[model samples]
Target: MDDIHAPTVASGLSSGIAPRDVSKVSMPDLMQEKERIEAELSALSSVLNSHGVNMNSSLTTFDGFPRDDIDIAQVRTTRVRIIHLRNDHKAVMTHLEKGLHDHFARLQNAPGATSANGTTVPSSAPTSVTDNSIADTGTLGTPFARVNSVEPGSPAHQAGLKMGDSIRGFGSVHWLNHERLSKVAEAVQQNEGRPLTVKVTRKNESGSGTTELDLQLTPRRNWGGRGLLGCHIVPL
Candidate 1:
């Protein structure tokens, strides 16, 4: 994990330049930049986790701690890199929020737009909308992790988890600052062999919408697997 380094933007932007000035850029480009930054952040998080370090943990906790098998210098360097990447990621999100605001503002001022109850309503807005009412039922909460892989005959597999399933909720793990999926790991360790509720979103075959599903998984040792989960859960 020491060899793992912070990933650069997929757009090939050089360092030392402000990367969130996308005011004039099209929506597609803004989205692409957001995706790239998100991927980089996820990669950095995985690197930190591989070293038995939680991304949200304070760096000072490592000071004067045992490091016979770990490179303290590398840990410090990676922590600094993660900080910079987080700032950049936040900037990109801010840019996207501003872009959306500007877009809606334009639509509100567009010709024939109506103001209803002090709220601007676009005239071309759909008269009726279909409600995919799975939020409250299917999903226990907002999705925070994604299942990357599940081992065959493992707890995850027996629980009906598949690759690409977005984990909406697992035990007490919610969407609150779940960039490292550390809460899920903690829950697994504390509730071994106990059934834990898992909520996930699976894409429909037609790719038009998503369907949420609830599953029960029990974590235990000596499962003849590598990890307690027997599956890779990455922050989404």
Candidate 2:
């Protein structure tokens, strides 16, 4: 974290660019913006760590007096900035998802055709739904783990994962192969920077029953949070 200077929270914790029409932006540009926000968030987290505090750490004692061990002023300011950056991160991810969807749509309508956004598709651009389909969603499998909490702006949140969602499958690690959740950790490690199909069952909006959902989650380090998924999971 010290390798990268912590951003000044007061200067604004946005992605360091003016808001533009996301539809008009190219997919690559959107991805770059996402990376930028994530890096800043990671740096901010390091700053908080240096101050010996976390988002949940109390800044005051039981008597409501400011604690003496840590910098209360800095901790409060950093917390606020992290909140703002998390919101910004979520917005950028939304735009990135839209860009990916639009990219795929254009490709389907015209195979190997130039992107509608007019930027030359990079050779490194992902080609398959399994690789980059953030919107490719469906339901399958049996429950193995349950999402107890989802952190805002974390990869789980970016992928539309929610609290109380029951994890039915995670990539190749299904209910049988999960090995008491160890395989889930292994899958996340092995698939860093690559999207993994996460199948989950959640209560329907109508509240009558449950429905399954498929989400593409990419895990990466230093996402300004504690874990790559920014979520807490427990075995069913």
Candidate 3:
């Protein structure tokens, strides 16, 4: 059987083997594996981003595209790596979830386990653990578009848009599967002369944490700008 089809330790024991308990897996080890998979995925995403492509974009062919500017062979290779990395990420996540479940189950079954409030903690007590480190993996309901440039006195400029700022969401354009940035264009055209909310993530000059900005931009033509947005946005 292929490696992909092979049974994993987390998938229970194979034929003629004793079933290994998930509780044997340490939480720290599971967390580390999760972080490693996330890092690999982030690295693959960066490679694709350098080529102006998102993880969701199909790279079937480079015809009529910037083959001269980008390394087509490198892109192809990275695409395959991304597929494998995504699969590995999924598997790791499954293992981590199971480990966490098993750990919490043991905790609840402990002899004298009680809540801080002196109440008996139920086994079904929320096992949900939030990891803030993964919060910036992507924006929710926001499209991540990089501002190429903003025309002076244009709607984008007037709205305080600057180059390098990532548009987390603008009007109806959210980060959910906005690989092509077509939603930003559609939002602009559909909301002309109307106030549109734009959320952006701007890197601080100190190179510390990012700053989130909520700007209201009114899209209009004849603002001495070429496009309705008055700013070039490229998918990141």
TM-score of each: 0.45, 0.44, 0.43
Across residues 1-236, which tens digit of lDDT does each residue of candidate 2 receive?
A: 22112334556544455555555667667656555666677788999999887888766678766678887667777777788767766776666655555665555467465656976654444433223232232311557789999999999999989999999778876643354577799989899999998988899989899887789999988889987789998977
RMSD, each candidate, Å?
10.1, 16.6, 12.0
Per-residue lDDT of model 1, residues 94-209, tens digit only: 66555545555566678777665766575442111111222232222657678989999889999999999998778756553233575578889899989988888899989899
lDDT of each: 0.66, 0.71, 0.65
The TM-score of predicted model 1 comes to 0.45
lDDT value, candidate 1, whole model: 0.66
The best candidate in terms of TM-score:
1
Count steric clashes of candidate 2: 0
Name the regions of candidate 1 deviating beyond 4 angstroms.
1-140, 177-179
Error of 1 at 119 (Å): 28
lDDT of model number 3: 0.65
Worst 10 residues of 2 by lDDT: 131-140
